[model samples]
Target: MNQTFDVQGMSCGHCERAVTQAVKALDAAARVRVDLATGKVQVETDQPREAVARAIAQEGYQVAAA
Candidate 1:
């Protein structure tokens, strides 16, 4: 499944990398793409929605909405 999350507090390349790594840590094969300007994360995984949200939040960002 593919999920798109509306994230907040991402302002640079480092922020994007953080989000990507956090998501990948949960699912090694998961594909992550972040849009820093829009604070959005696109992930491909079968994991639960809340799991993904929590992973992103752990990276110090707010998961706005789906």
Candidate 2:
């Protein structure tokens, strides 16, 4: 599934990597793309949306309604 999430508090490349890593930790094959300027994250994975959101949140980012 392809999902887009509205995230907050991502300010730089490090933040992007953190979010991507957090998601990938849950699903190694998952593809994660973060747009810092837009505070959005695009992910392609088989995991449930809630799981994906939670993982991102666990990375210290806030996940807003998509």
Candidate 3:
């Protein structure tokens, strides 16, 4: 499944890497792409939406409503 999240508080490459790492840690095969300027994250994984949201949140970013 593909999920798009409106992530807040991401302003730099480090922030993007943190979000990507957090998601990938949960699903090794998961693919993550972030648009920092737009505060958007696109993830491809089989995991549930809540799980993905939690992972991103754990990285200290807010996941906006879809």
Candidate 4:
């Protein structure tokens, strides 16, 4: 599944890496693209959207409710 999430608190490369890693932790094969400027996170994964969002949230970022 592909999902786009509105995530805040991302300001640098580290933030992008954090979000990507968080998503990857859930599904090793998942693809994550974080656009800090737009506060958008695009993810392609087999996991559920909730699980992916929770992972990003657990990384200290705010995942806006969709």
Candidate 5:
């Protein structure tokens, strides 16, 4: 499934990496794209939306409710 999340507090490349890593940790094959300027995170994975959101949250970024 493809999911788009509204995230906050991402201000740098490291932040993007962190968010991407967080999602990948849940699914190695998952694809993650982060846009700092818009705080948008686009992910393609088999994982559920909540699970993906949790992973991102665990990385310390706020995942806004969809």
Candidate 6:
């Protein structure tokens, strides 16, 4: 499934990497793209939306409603 999330508190490249890594930890084949300026994260993964959101939350980022 493909999901787009409004992710807050991503200020730099490290934050981007952290979010990507966190999702990848859940699904190794997942594809993650982050737009820091827009605070949007577009992910293509097999995992459910809730699981992905929780992973982002666990990474210390807020996942806004889609």
Q: Scored by CA lDDT, what does every candidate get?
A: 0.90, 0.93, 0.93, 0.90, 0.92, 0.95
Best by lDDT: 6
Tens-place lDDT digits, model 2, residues 1-66: 999999999999999999999999999999998889999899999999999999999988889757
TM-score of each: 0.94, 0.95, 0.95, 0.94, 0.94, 0.96
Cα lDDT over the full model 5: 0.92
Winner of 3 and 5 under TM-score: 3
Which residue pairs in candidate 1 collide?
none
Question: Lowest summed lDDT over 10 consecutive residues: which window, candidate 1?
Answer: 57-66
Q: Is candidate 1 or candidate 3 better by TM-score?
A: 3
Error of 3 at 4 (Å): 0.3
Q: Which digits, one per residue and each the tens of the lDDT, describe model 5 over residues 1-66?
A: 889999999999999999998889899999998889999999999999999999999989889864
The residue ranges of model 4 lying beyond 4 angstroms of the native Cα positions read none
Q: Write the per-residue lDDT of candidate 6 for residues 1-66, one digit (tens) a residue.
A: 889999999999999999999999999999999999999999999899999999999999999856
- Model 1, 1-66: lDDT tens digits are 999999999999889888989999999999998988777789999999899999999988889666
lDDT of 6: 0.95
Candidate 6: segments with Cα more than 4 A from true spot: none
Error of 5 at 52 (Å): 0.3
Which residue pairs of candidate 6 clash?
none
- Candidate with the larger lDDT of 1 and 3: 3
The Cα RMSD of model 2 versus the native structure comes to 0.7
Off by over 4 Å in 2: none
